[model samples]
Target: MNANELTIAEARDALAGGELSAVDLTMACLTAIDAGTPLNAFVHATPEIALDQARAADARRGADAGALNGIPLGIKDLFCTRGVASQAASNILKGFKPEYESTVTSKLFEAGAVMLGKLNMDEFAMGSSNETSCYGDAVNPWKVDDRKLTPGGSSGGSAAAVAADLCLAATGTDTGGSIRQPAAFTGIVGIKPTYGRVSRWGIVAFASSLDQAGPMTKSVRDAAILLGAMAGHDPKDSTSADIPVPDFEAALTGDIRGRKIGIPREYRMEGMPAEIEALWARGREMLADAGAEIVDISLPHTKYALPAYYVIAPAEASSNLARYDGVRYGHRARLGQGDGIVDMYEKTRAEGFGKEVQRRVMIGTYVLSAGFYDAYYNRARKVRALIKRDFDEAFAAGVDAILTPATPSSAFGLGEMADADPVAMYLNDVFTVTVNLAGLPGISVPVGLDAKGLPLGLQLIGRPWDEAGLLNHAHVLERAAGFVEKPRKWW
Candidate 1:
């Protein structure tokens, strides 16, 4: 197998044994990233940085080397990588390079991981499909015939890069299913840690309360390894959890017997595809076969999750994104003869942000406006609290985790929903937004392929700050399903 195709665990062992050189592994990934340009996965390939990091890691390889020593990773564009372009896949932030690194990236770097480049994402992390990216759509490697599919978003590029083996793993942020949805679509593992588990210090803000960075990788084990390196407490982010970071990789014992897994009846949405239903059933059966007791549970407020998430995410986005006017860093609009500060702000934003971003910003502004604040924003907050309560009740009743479909369907073709209602696209997050709203840890594990040869995944939602347990459950499911199919080398 190619060096770049090695999983994190495998590569770590090889590097430790002196069987593989860090520079060679990084070069192999750089080669893959270069050859896989058609997929648009690495929006900004950092070959020099990756090689330098790899060399440093090789020199430090000893008792002092960290868990992620020599692993090459693609960082999501949303992360603020110091001196590198961290545009968040939006034109508004074009040429904007942060003076400092995000806590997640910093942790990974401290652990000796190499940075391959910045991956594409939905502009401001606003859309369900990666089509909203200013860097152009990050095409899915899993294509059917001549049609290109979306890798799901806004972590689509991260998913594509990992699935395509351009990198062993990538950093992904989930606002509402961005990481898990893309991972599902691409037949990989993506986990969104409990809301405060990973520090969000330098990550470009989406929905502050909802956004959490996690690892997207080839397997659950790789996810665990990468996540361990990425997660830790940081004094920089106010919402960052002060809890201790556990050894996530050691938690994958694959012994899930006696665990209570909840199958929420509310997840069986109307007009759901038969394939997705079958996949969910198979996931439940697999867990049961492995000795986990599947219990029917009720998260009755699941129906309101989508609408509530839309209101809350966008509202927070509006507040977080207000700092991006023309006067500061990034793109600035040329002034007209009489254009004042207000006019410049309007013109710069109008010229910089994409249509999907503009739409969300407007919706957010309207909902947070004085007249409608109580009617929409406050109502959504109340609903979010109720959603959390539902999960709390289930956990309190001894449920270990909740099982549901990661996405309603497999990867859809790029531009397939261009003319359709935006609500149709929003429906893609139906199964995922609830996890973010409840501030719970969630993981998407590829279970099987659909009739169309596309990959499908099942979500396992865990208790807050229980990523170790969540990963073990997912590891069990992964072993049971034996989903080894890879997307054909179309890219």
Candidate 2:
């Protein structure tokens, strides 16, 4: 296999056996990134930094190497990589490079991982499709009838890069399905750990309460291997959990026999595609054949999840994004002849933020306004608690995990929903937003394909801090599904 095509586990073994050097592997990925520019997955390529780290990793290979030693990984632009451009794919943060590293990236570097560069993302992770990015959309490698598709956003770049062999694995954040949706669209594995499992410090904030970092990789095992390194408590982030991080990869025994997987009745929504239903049924059979029990359950509050999420996420986004005024850091607008500070703030924001971001901010501000807070924002929080209660009840009933379709459909074409109502786009997160709302670990594993030959993914929602078990069960599904199809290189 090509060096860039090797899974994290495969590359680790190859490097350990002296068959491949970290420098060679990093260079291979760099070469692929250069040649795959049409995909727009990598917004910046740090070949010099990558080689320097690779050389350092090479020197430490004998005795001082760490868990991710000599591994080359792509960082989502949302991560504050020290001395690298970390714009979160927004014009607002133009030319901004952090003086410090995010806890997650810092941990990865401490484990001897090399940084290839910054990957693209939806501006502040506000969109379901990658088109909201200021750097432009990251094209999905999978195409149908010559129509280019979107690797779902805002982690589209991470998913696209991994799927197209531009990186071994990349970091991604989940806020209203940014990570898992893109992974489902790109035919890769993406996991969003329970809220606070990964520290949010140094990550560009979107919806602070809902955002969580996780790994997007080629296989479930790779997700496990990377997540073990990415997770842990951090003093820097108050929301970070204080629990001990478990050995995620080692826990992948793939023995899910007797595990009860719940199939939520509310997930079977009106107008859901037949292919999605069929695939769900197939997933149930696969798990059942593997000796697991599939039980019918109901998350009665499911209908309210999307609306509540929209309200809560935007409200937090409005608060978290308030720090981007022209006075401090980032892009500042030039003052007009008689304009005051207020005008400067307005102009800077108008020029810096994209349409979708501005829209969300406005909606958030309106909802949080004194007059509307009780009706919208406050009610949403109450509904969010109920959503969490629903999951808690299911788990309390002995459901080990919940099984459902990762997405309502397969990868859709770029510009497919350009002129449509925005709610039409929000529907993409219907199957995913609840996990974030309820603060549970969730994963998307490539299971099959749709009629157009694009990839489809199945999601498994797990109990809080039970990522090891969730990944183990996903490994069983991965092996049973045997989904190894790769998109033919069209970019």
Candidate 3:
């Protein structure tokens, strides 16, 4: 197999055994990135930075070398990489570069991982489809005939890069299913650790309370390895948890015997596709066959999750994004002769933000407005609390993990929903937002292919800070499904 196609585990072993050089692996990925430009997976290419790090890793090779030493991975555009373009796929921050690295990137670098470049994402992470990106949609490597499919968002580029072998793996953030949905659509593995499990210090904000960074990789084991290097306590981020980081890769024994997996009845939506339903049923049987007891559970507030997420995410987004008013940094609109400060703010924002971003910001601003705060923002907050309570109740009742469909459908074509009602796109996050609302760990594992030959995935939601256990459950599902399909190289 090509070096670029190797999983993290395989690459690590080869690097350790002196069979593979860091430079070679880095070159392999860089070459793939250049050849795969049609997919627009990478918005920035950092060959100089990557090669410097790889050479340093070669010289420092020893027993004390970091876990990811010499490993090449892609960084999401949301991360603030010192001296690299750190725009979060938005025009507002075009040409902006950070002076300091984000906590996650710093940790990965400390652990010896090399960065290829920054991957594309939804503008400010405000959309479910990658179409919201200012760089144009990051096309999925998977295609049916001549139609182009979305890789999912706001981590679409991360998903596409990893799935297409443009990089060994990539960093991704999930606010409302960005990581998991893309992983599902691209037939890979993605895990959104519990909120606060990973530091938010360097990642660009979307919804402060809901956004959590994670790894997107070729396999469950790769996800585990990358998550180990990416997670730790960060004094820089106040919301970062102080818990001890475990050896996540070692926790994957692929034995989920006697674990209680809950199948939330609320997840069975009224118009759910028969293929998705069948996929969910198959997931249940797989877990049961692996000795996990499948039990019916109720998260009654599931129906309210989508509405509540819309209000709360936008409300937080509006507040967090207020910092990008062209006063401090980023794109500033050229004002007319007599324009004042307010005019610059209005014009800069009008010119910088895409339509989807503007829509969410407006919704957020409206919900948080004086007269509507109680009716929208506050009410949504209350519903969010209930959603958390529902998950907590299930876990408290001996449920080891909860299983659900990662997305309502498989990958959809680009522009398929762009011109449709925005809510139609929001419905894509129906199964995912609840996990973010409750601040719990969740993962998407590819199980089977749809009738159209596209991949489908199932989600496994775990208790807060229980990613190791959740990963083990997913590992078992991955093993049972034995899904080895890859997108034909159309790029």
Candidate 4:
């Protein structure tokens, strides 16, 4: 395989064996990124920074090397990389270079990973498709009928970069299916560890409670290796869980015998495509063949998860984004002659935020308004609790994991939904929002293809803090599916 095409695990082994140097791998990725610029996967390119890190990794070759030694990876723009522009794909934070690194990225660097650049994402992670990005929509590497498809969002660029072989893997944050949906769309592996499993210290907040950082890689094993380097408790983030970080790669024994996998009845929504249903059925049979027991289950409150998530996520986003007024860091509007402070605030925000972000902020502010708080936000919180309880009940009944379709459908064209209702876009997350609402671990593994030759993915939802087992089960499924198709490089 080409150096740029190597997975994290493969690259790490080659580097350690002296078969490949870190500089060669880094340059190969840089070349791929340069050639794939039409995809708009990366909003920023840090070739110099990548080379410096590669040289340093080369120097630490012998006994001092770390687990991720000499690995080249991409950082999501949402991550606060010190001295790098971390804009989160929003114009409000354009040119805002943080002075410190996020805890997750810091841990990856400590393990000797090199940063290629910052990948694109939805503006403030507010959209299901990457169209909300201020940096222009990231085109999926996968195409159908010569149409440019979307690489789901808000982690679209991470998924695109990985699928296109621009990087070994990339950082991604899941806020209501951002990571998993995009991974599904682009035929890659993405895992959102249980909330608090990975620190959120310097990641730009979208919805404080639901957003969790994870890895987007070329394979299940690569996801495991990257997750190990990214997961750890951080004192800087109060929500970070103080738990033992396991060797995620070592946990992939692929021995899932006797494990009970749940097929949630609620996931079988009306109008679900026959292809998705067939894919789900195939995933069940694969797991059953691997010695896992398949059991019918019901997450009764699943219907309400999407509604409750929209309410709660937007409410938290409104509060969290209030800090972006022109007074502090990030872009500020030029004051007009005789204009008041209110005018500056309004104009600056109006110019900075995208349409989708503004809409959510308004929805959030209205939901949290004095007269509507009890009716909307508070009610949503109660419904959120019930959703969590539903998952809890399922786990208590011996369901080791839950399997479902990762996305409602395969990737759609980039502008297909532009004129459609916003709620239509929101429906894309119907299969994914419940996992974020319940704060559990979820992974998307590409298993098959849709009618148009686009990839389809199966999601595996696990109990809190049980990522090791979740990854093991996913590994079994991946091996059974054996999907190795790559996008024909039309870009």
Candidate 5:
């Protein structure tokens, strides 16, 4: 059996049925990672620890088993894992080990999931491509051959590991498009559940309001399974929804015969590559073919989403990341000190944050500063309200969901956009950011390959707490698109 290709749902069923032991699953993941290391899909792999956990899980099955008796998953480095280095893929957090695991990760543990190890990512989940990692970039698995293509970031490694079958599925965080974009590039399914659906407490916060963790997997059902394990109310995370957790697994109705899907014309912009546009059009056709009613809708605030997200997310990020300045925790950079404590904040911040992080902080500082607060930060906040209002209007108008190209283009070669103006790179997140800003659920599912043979993905957006609807829509499109490709062993 192709263990690498097995979905989390399938693997658990097999494990439950005693067809494959947790030991078998662990070995499969370790073997796949050993083979996939050339692609640099993972930052860390603790085979011994994983084996121990698998053994414990196998023993538990002999006692009382659960749905996730023995699934192995790649954890994004951003989630704080107690006693493990949760570095956020940045040099600044190099030696920072947490005393407590993030709430989402702990729940995954309780659900009986085994940890494969920490996966790589863009520094502080900042970039569109994985090139921003202090450890170096993660390569896309489906470059058709050994051709170099970026696994999208900041959750690039999470997506790549899933694509290369390095892990059954991996945890991913989407502050902007981190999860969705990378998932799109690697030809996998990744969902950014509604903001606050998954607890952010102990997650290395990039942008408090926008930062959210979800699942990256080969199939929609797998995404659903993992999301279920990661999501719940946590008193520790004030923003976490107090709403009831639904049966994400049970919500998978393979039929969406009469649903209304809206195609926002604003998403069909001038900069979108022809291949991506075709994929978007193909998605509409796929849903229509699946008996879904398709309609043309306008998210009048669409064009404003990217800018609004850039402003608000960074503003929140600056505040959230302020804690990393030298003293209390993380990599204490050698900062020139003045006589007092205030000097530490200044010197430490200057030394600790990377250039990109510094840039956002400065931008945030400038926007939130006395003179500009009303004009910049406040205006962006108002626009955020409009963006959410736009989604509410669409849903109220009877639109069950919306569709757009997950990315404007497929995976670009690493370093192609790295040295360009940082704003240039941020532009690539255009499609995925709005969902985060609106606190709505969204997903990316691979649809086809591009001219360079890199995978392309189509994104589906749904109402808040409507992950099930999003997954059903994606499954329908996945079937209609008829797209599936595996990484060749050339790497």
Candidate 6:
């Protein structure tokens, strides 16, 4: 029945109709996992435990199961899972299972979703490529003439697991393109909600102000279905907005016809690969063909977004990572005689955090330090506000959404750019960072593929709380573009 390729909604319907059983679905996923674990796609799998949960879900189906009842999903290790080893792909947190489950996972459980296991991610969700994980990175399921490819990060494992049909839909977090980039790499639908739309409670902090958990699904509607179950406010997270949740599933039916989509002129800059440029142009045409009016807009402060986000997110990450000082959590370095409490903290952080994490922490601390606070941190914040204002102006000018390329190029090899200078690697995030700085909702859906046969994706940026509008346009574009992304043995 190709259970691996079924959408989350389809799997649930099959289970409900008795055409499939929770145990049957779980077994197929476990079988796939057993075959793919050597690919390093998962950090851990609880098949026995997963089967137990599946049994419970099936029992509930016998009683009055809901839409998502009995579907198994892969959870990114960044989310806290009680009793499941919830390490954020780091060495220090090894064997340090959390005592509680994250809000998102908890909500999914209430909706009757089962967990296959914990998927891999970059340590502390730091790197763009999952190569920085304490565990090995996830290999892309897509192949280009026997050559290995990449599943983007820090949600690469989630993307790869879903692509490999190891799980239905997986949870992902996008601080600055983590979710969307990986989705692009694996040809899946990834949506990062407007900041504060999803509760941050129980998520291991990376860049606190920017960290947002979302869904990675096979279809936009499935993404909406999963998101509907995950979105809500929680008193535990102070930054959570108390806005009423909408039925995103119902909202998907709204038409984006006659709507306005703006193409930020600043985004189409020099050095953009030809394929990406073509995809962006094709995206605008697709929207236009679907009755959307495409406008040429300017965001002068757009170029400053990457720099500001690099500074701001690192600063927040440095603060959020301070809790991993070996006493309250994670690993702690041995204290020496005559050394004060401060030394223990310093040594612990040095030993616990990986190289990339330490590099970011130092950069963050330096920028937010007393000497450079105003010149760097404060100025960046002001620039961030200006960037958001740019979006505000565009939205006010009748732009319902913005369209752009998801990446400058398709997925590269596993280490294709690892040593070609970090600046180049960081540059890969150029297209997705601005959306984060504006605190807007953004998604990446497969638009087409490059000549190398790697997947290419289009990014959709939306106004705050306008996710419904964004998804509607995305679905319309999906059909209008006729971008069928069936890879020949790609997954």
lDDT of each: 0.94, 0.94, 0.95, 0.94, 0.85, 0.86
**Residue clash pairs of candidate 3:** none
List residue ranges in candidate 4 displaced over 4 A: none
Task: Kindly give the stretch of ten consecutive residues in candidate 2 with the minimal lDDT sum.
Answer: 58-67
Worst 10 residues of 1 by lDDT: 225-234
Over 4 Å off, model 5 = 145-147, 335-347
Residues 1-491 of candidate 6: C-alpha lDDT, one tens digit per residue: 57766889899778988999988898888888887865578788888778998999988886577657888899999999998898898877877888898999999998988899999888888888898898887888877776677788899899988877889999999998999999988888899999999999989899888889999988888888998889999989998899988888787764777899999999987889888898888998888877889989998898998889889999998888777877776777888899888898889878777888888988999999998999999999999999989999999999999998888788888878777777687777898988888889999888788998788889999989988888888887777766656555433
- In model 5, state the lDDT of residue 312: 85
Q: What is the Cα-based TM-score of model 6?
A: 0.96
Query: Tens digits of per-residue lDDT for model 1 on 1-491?
Result: 99999999999999999999999999999999989999998998889999999999999999999999999999999999999999999988999999998889999999999999999999988887899999999999998778999999999999999999999999999999999999999999999999998999999998899999999999999999988888888898899889998999899999999999999999998899999999999999999999999999999999999999999998998898899897879999999999899999999999998988888889999999999999999999999999999999999999999999999999999999988999999999999999999999999999999989999999999999999999999999999999999999966
Per-structure clash totals for the candidates: 0, 0, 0, 0, 0, 0
Candidate 3 TM-score, true structure as reference: 0.99
Q: Judging by lDDT, tell me the better candidate of 4 and 5.
A: 4
lDDT of 5 by residue, 377-464 (tens): 9999999899899999999999999988898888788878767888788888989888988999999988888887778899999988
Model 6 residue 98 CA deviation (Å) reads: 1.1
Model 6: lDDT equals: 0.86
Question: RMSD to the native, candidate 4?
Answer: 0.7
TM-score of each: 0.99, 0.99, 0.99, 0.99, 0.96, 0.96
For 1-491, candidate 3 gives per-residue lDDT tens digits of 89999999999999999999999999999999999999999999999999999999998898999999999999999999999999999999987999999999999999999999999999998887799888999999998778999999999999999999999999999999999999999999999999999999989999999999999999999999999998988998999999998989899998888999999999999999999999999999999999999999999999999999999999999999999999888999999999999999999999999998899999999999999999999999999999999999999999999999999999999999978999999999999999999999999999999999999999999998999999999999999999999999987
lDDT of 1: 0.94
lDDT of 5 at 94: 74
Instruction: Give the candidate number with the greatest lDDT.
Output: 3
Worst 10 residues of 5 by lDDT: 331-340
lDDT of 4 by residue, 1-491 (tens): 78999988889888989999999999999999999999999999999999999999999997789888889999989999999999989999988999998999899999999999999899998888899999999999998786889999999999999999999999999989999999999999999999999999999999999999999999999999999989988999999999999988899998999999999999999999999999999999999999999999989999999899999999999999999998888999998899998998999999999999999999999999999999999999999999999999999999999999999999999999999999999999999999999999999999998989999999999999999999999999999999999998888
lDDT of model 2, residue 117: 98
